[model samples]
Target: MIASFPYLIVGLLFLFGLYAVVFERNLIKIAIGISVIEAATNMFLIVLGYRTGGRIPVFTLAGESKVLVLPTPQALTLTAIVIGMATTALMLSLIMVLYRHYGTLDVREIRRLRG
Candidate 1:
C-alpha cells in the first residue's frame, strides 16, 4: 500500500488536469491544464525509475555498493520536458495568432469562424 501512494497521487493529478483541459472554456486554461497533466505523468515516470533508498546514478557518487537511481526515467523526463516546452511554445504562438485574428481567447467564440 505504501509503495503505490506516490503513483496514486500522480495519477490523480493527471486526471484532474485532464478534466480541467476538457472542461475549460478558455484556450489558455486548456493549454495550462495539458501542461499540468504532462508534468504529473513525467513526475510519475521519474518516481517509478527511482528505487527504494537509491542513490544518484553517478558512478563517482557511490562506490558501487549503493543502488543506483534509474537513469532511463530521468532521460525520458528530460525529453518529455523538452517536448512539453516546445508544445507550449507552439500553442502559445498559435494562441497569439488566434488572438490577433479574433481578438478573443475564448475557444467557444472561435467556432463562429469555422463556418
Candidate 2:
C-alpha cells in the first residue's frame, strides 16, 4: 500500500487538475490547472525512475553496488519542465491579450464576444 502512495498522489493531482480545467470559469484558474497537470506528470516521471538504495551514475566515486537511478526519465522530466514553462508562459500571454481585447477572462464571455 505504501509503495503505491506516489501513484495515488499523482492520480489525485491529475484528477483535480482535470476538474479545474473543465469546470473553472476564471482563466487564471485554468492556467493553474494546466500547471498542476504538468506537475503531476513530472512527479509521475520521477516516481517511475526512482530506485531504492540507488546511487548516482558516477564513475569516479565508484561503489561496490552497481544500482543507479535511471537517467532517461529524469532527463525527460527536465525537458518537460522546460517545455511546460514556455508553454505556460505563452498561454498566460495569450490570456492577457484576450483579456485586453475582450475585457474579460471568462471563456464563456470570450466565446460570446466572438459572435
Candidate 3:
C-alpha cells in the first residue's frame, strides 16, 4: 500500500484539477487547475522512471554493472515543466486582458460579453 502512495496522490491531484477546470467559474481558478494538472502529469512521468538502487546512466568501470534509471522521462518532464510555465503565463495574460475588457474574472460574464 505504501508503495502506491505516490500514484494515489497523483491520481487525486489530476482529479482535483479536472474538477476545478470543469466547475470553477473564475479565470484564475481555471489557470490554477491547468497548472495542477500539468504538475500531476510531470510527477507521474518522474515516478514512472524511478527505480530502487538505480544509478545515473554513465559509463563506469569495466567490472561495474548496475541498474540505471531511464533518463528520457526526466528530460521529458523538464521540457514539459518549461512549456507549462510558458502556457500558464500566456493564460494569465489573456485572463488579465479579458478582465480589463469584461470588468470581471467570471467566465460566464466573459462568455456573455462575447455574444
Candidate 4:
C-alpha cells in the first residue's frame, strides 16, 4: 500500500489538473493546469522506471550481472520534460499575446471579443 503512494499522488495531481482545465475560467489558471498535468506525467514516467535494489543499466568490467532498472522510461521522461518546457513557454507567450489584445485573461472575455 505504501509503495503505491507515489502513483496515487500522481493520479491526484492529474485529476486536479484535469479539473482545473475543465472548470477554470481564467486563461492563466488553465495554462498552469496544463503544466501540472505535464509534471504528473513526467513523474509517472520516472516512477515507472524505478526499481528496488536495482543497479544502473551500465555494462561493468567484471561482467553483466544483477538486476538493472529499465532506462527507457527515464529517457522518455527527460525528453518529455524538454518538450513540456518548450510547450509551456509557447503557451504562456500566446497567453500574453491574448491578454495584450483582449485586455483580459478571462477565456469568456477573450472569446466574446474575438474578431
**Which tens-of-lDDT digit does each residue in 1-115 have in candidate 4?**
9899999999999999999999999988999999999999999998999888777777554246677788999999999999999999999999999888889999888888876
- Could you tell me the TM-score of candidate 3? 0.92
Instruction: Name the runs in model 3 displaced over 4 angstroms.
Output: 59-64
Error of 2 at 6 (Å): 0.5
Query: What overall lDDT goes with each candidate model?
Result: 0.90, 0.94, 0.92, 0.91
Per-structure clash totals for the candidates = 0, 0, 0, 0
Question: What TM-score should be assigned to candidate 4?
Answer: 0.92
Q: lDDT-based ranking, best first?
A: 2, 3, 4, 1
The TM-score values for the models, in the order shown, are: 0.89, 0.93, 0.92, 0.92
Tens digit of per-residue lDDT, candidate 1, span 73-98: 99999999999999999999999999
Full ranking by TM-score: 2, 3, 4, 1
Highest TM-score model number: 2
lDDT of 2 at 79: 100
Q: Which lDDT value does model 2 have at 5?
A: 99
lDDT of 4 at 106: 93
Segments in model 1 whose C-alpha atoms lie over 4 Å from true places: 60-65
- Residue pairs clashing, model 1: none
The lDDT leader among the candidates is 2
| Lowest-sum lDDT 10-residue window in model 1 | 56-65
